[model samples]
Target: MIAPMALARPSPQELWEMDRQHLLHPWTNFGPFEREGALVITRGEGCHLWDAEGRRYFDAVGGMWCTNVGLGRREMAAAMAEQAERLAFSNTFVDVTNDPSARLAARLADLAPGDLNRVHFTTGGSTAVDTAVRMVWYWQSCMGRPEKTDIVARDHSYHGATYLSQSVGKRPGDRVAEFRYKETGIHHLSAPNPYRRPEGMSEAQFCDALVAEFEALIVQVGADRIGGFIAEPIQASGGVIVPPQGYLRRMWEICQRHDILFIADEVVTAFGRLGHWFASEAEFGVVPDMITCAKGLTSGYVPLGAVIFSDRIWQAMAANGERWFTSGFTYSGHPVSCAVGLKNLEIIEREGLLENAARVGDYFLERLQALEALPLVGQVRGRRLMVCVENVADKATKAPLPDGVNESKRISDAAEAMGMMVRPLGHLNVMSPALTITEADVDFVAETLERAIRQVTDELVREGHRIG
Candidate 1:
């Protein structure tokens, strides 16, 4: 047989040109894309990434808050390869099953809190959330309550990118592209952002007000018209806005009273991100009716997402004799992805990553808290590894930096130049480093971020922004 043609390894310039020509990146600013092009990251290993030119940078964003096991794991690779060779693609449809998928479902059930045992695997977070929405509608329809079809979502909460999922999402910028489903039965409430609460209101008062608002909405909208409420334990994409104390629990109580299904979108907070397999009940003391999770499920090693629902949903379906859910994906529970998930879970357990996240994440936040002393830092807030540093023009007034200042972008650019990566969300810089991160890694991140913030402060002063 003739030897296989050798694979071509494109040079850095060639790679960059190819990306600029063909790749359409997500959440991209086209103007900047046309001007600067994308950074071609070639490889990653243990909380760090290397660009095409072989420059190393600390992955403070944890590969978009997913790479909990870090990167470049030989075991993860081996598991994927082995599963692919054994039984890579199998349709997990009616009368069909795969070993990895079944096993993982059981494992997740064991790990999940309460009766969140039924698992519906999807290709990624968006689809998982889409599935949850579909199920809510389906369940309501099946129960002969089609009128109770509206979904309640919080402002600035990110569920996913799918049409239905994005319809439920309320990020103002995310809606600028348009084409969202109009007449979609979705409602929104104010985000439980304590920092932005009305002046003279304590955090406890803010929490009470938010819960009251939720209850009032339910009453005003008529609970008979509401089917589900979806929220993130921590609004990850919305500048890591941590809800006030008792917010989630109180919301769940209202949902219970209103006969509404509560869906905790744990896409970013699950699977060791918050030092737990699931953060809904573990971190927030709320056992939601459903939890849509992805990201750290497979530690960014492969694409996999799941919706873990309570037995009430399962029982409803079971009680409906001969009625099929009639929803699934061609690659739902792909054996390779499931196998990788199993191995990822195994790695997390064996390596004690959960405990590591808890310990190191606390230290990391403590170190980042020091940055609040900086003039531009309005607040530093987070739990475990997920954190955000909000930039402000006036700290005492808590006024946001001028949009033209591009404060977060400037800080992210400065950090990148100094060998670190952080996500720039408007006026905030968000970070969710790998669970494998160490105290030393936290030190590096803190130092780099401090330097970046200081540099940006100087630039802002030079630009005459009059930051205080």
Candidate 2:
């Protein structure tokens, strides 16, 4: 139950002024900032959100691909409230312990695939990834392999915004930019994009080529110098790039053969996003040495993330008896965050949302596939609830819309005007609604997108833009 707050919230105009005056948003280009004020979201409930002006929107993007169980779960609010009242703050720096933290750690250990039973919590996805990559250095140092100090990731992988994580992400613009950048030993391999691969290559051959590229890179980097290899099962924040089948398995084999520690950054795939609690093992058929997950961990109710390491690595770290290589956050194992996670996992299991995602996902993708009939649609691909609709000028050439045209943003605006909110990654429209979304909701979203794409196409065609 939501506790009744007696405080009067700021008006939309008031809030926007305050934000514009002081708040700088992440990933926003502020040179041409909106003078009328930003869209202020005042409240949310079950797969939907409302602006301060009372405009309701179906949140197809799931609050930046988090919000697994939708929104406004009074139980989750109550759980956090109870925990906050019980113990609001506690540092997990040293020997400190808390019930929610301890219990959530065990819960993660139980759910994590294979022997990835060790849990180290963090504030969010970026920190989790930052910590995991740093752990690779520590692991190598502890094991006396200090020469292995490099991190290899895909060119399209989205790790985090931290120095090490951002260094590895190959992107033109930041999800959130930073002044302090590093061009250290972190290297980026070619992104695995089947849609954009050379025309006429079979999926099998494409997979082999990708594996070969990774292997060649490892050789060039020198096996002894590379400490870890990381990848997202489904590359989120980078256009939801789903690689060819058997590609990840092959990559895993390559990493193992090269003695490189494999880390699966499942920040976007874990917790029912791909119809699995963990996709590193379930979807890809490879158990990573470390798995970093967040976002859906607490369903956006509380900030939390974790890196689950294998038992062997934990044992090795433990073996560093007298000496220690330490890295931790002030809110590393924040009790309130863990409590929310516990409740969120329960909701996922109790409602069988994972199974729901697996079942409804087929229908969802099918409905989305209907949009392929649209002239502007370049490709429609996704697994389970995570979907993308790429708008292209030429389907045959896979040519993106004219530079600076912002076709994706146009589609997003059209969708919003039609009562749905989808995220735009360049020309790709990303839709990852709540895992508990139904076939009806999928239809609504697809139909809205269809209308939006049609309108956007007409606009582009009239403007003399190239068309398929």
Candidate 3:
């Protein structure tokens, strides 16, 4: 029999005080953070995480929608170390390039769908999204269509946290007020939420209604004034909202017809999260003019992102001027990050994580759907590894619970106590476990979620909230 080994570490309270004193977390409401500090995750292995006190918990969100290959990868570390020993960094500016950057770019282009043949690297998802918006501006200006200035996004969309990307994404709270340049022309459409679909409509009809909504908005704003239509195949932070079938294709057709660039923000869905390298074309049957990806590109080992472009967009971009793009970061194509990305992709391919995601995603969704039997579960939905369990106030009317409802958070906390991690967003508990998660792992998540949901449901019932 093997005995557990103990290692000395700082006390949890000490670490918590240090984190609260120095670290400023993103998308956080710091009043509570000031009082409670943060969850100090010490390390991760496979689909599980260990906190500072060595409490094990399944990472149901894959470390904020990255970590497709899971955690504690020795080979990935070795790849980064090898690259650091050889060539750690280089400037991709001035036509300079490194082996890993060049090869990884080509590898991404080949894996991406359609004529998305060009790659522009960035530091991470936020930068990638901002870069895509800039590229759209550049593309339109090069084509002598400067009037196309407005970017069209949807409700519940999360592009990034950069200034431009914050304007591109929907609200998290009052964070938008801090920006000096107010969002003027960014248009937002209704979120494609099927669970809250209009009364008495089939899934296909709801899709048509949503498309019509977009068309009417375009007409209201005038197609000539629009620059691009940015969308996520699956809205991650937006309660894991999945649109009706054929919605993506129709939206693409409308964008093409209006001469507007189609930007697929696959920062969350790309790299096997949706059972493919890119879900826009592979799963949705439409090709985007541009796609911004990060997150799983290097599986969280290193920060990296890429702006993939179609031939049409690239041709317009190259014909603009000879004076270089005057964009990109010092670490845009850092050889070390790219080297890790190259090895990461090779690992994903060699281990067949994509295939695993496809096969297990169905099982995963099925497991979530089983929660519909619980009165507290309003709806269960998702694709592949990404799934959600929505707690409702009323199932007959599909009414949402009151704002500031804390049951979701409590349930998530309970799940963590049961050795599982989940993301709670507006009464929705979201899960996007690693692609490397097995069927047994799926069962573990499903069973733990059921227990947590029931515990919360019983409490809510006793409180007479009627949440179902």
| lDDT of each residue in 119-235, candidate 1, tens digit only | 999989999999998899888777778899899999988888988888888875788744746445789999989889999999999999999998888878899999999999999
Clash number for model 1? Answer: 0
Alpha carbon lDDT at 245, candidate 3: 87
Winner on lDDT (2 vs 3): 3
In the predicted model 1, the residue pairs found to clash are none
Error of 2 at 365 (Å): 1.2
lDDT tens digits, residue span 238-262, model 3 = 8788888889999999998988999
Candidate 2 lDDT, tens digit per residue, 386-452? 8898888888899887659999988898999999999988889998999989888988998899999
Clashes of each: 0, 0, 0
Instruction: Score candidate 3 by TM-score against the native.
Output: 0.95
Residue 208 shift from truth in candidate 1, angstroms: 1.1
On lDDT, the candidate that comes out on top is 1
TM-score computed on alpha carbons, candidate 2: 0.96
In model 2, the runs with Cα more than 4 Å from the true position are: 1-8, 175-180
User: Model 1 — which ten-residue stretch has the worst lDDT?
Assistant: 176-185
Candidate that beats the other on TM-score, 1 or 3, i.e. the better one:
1
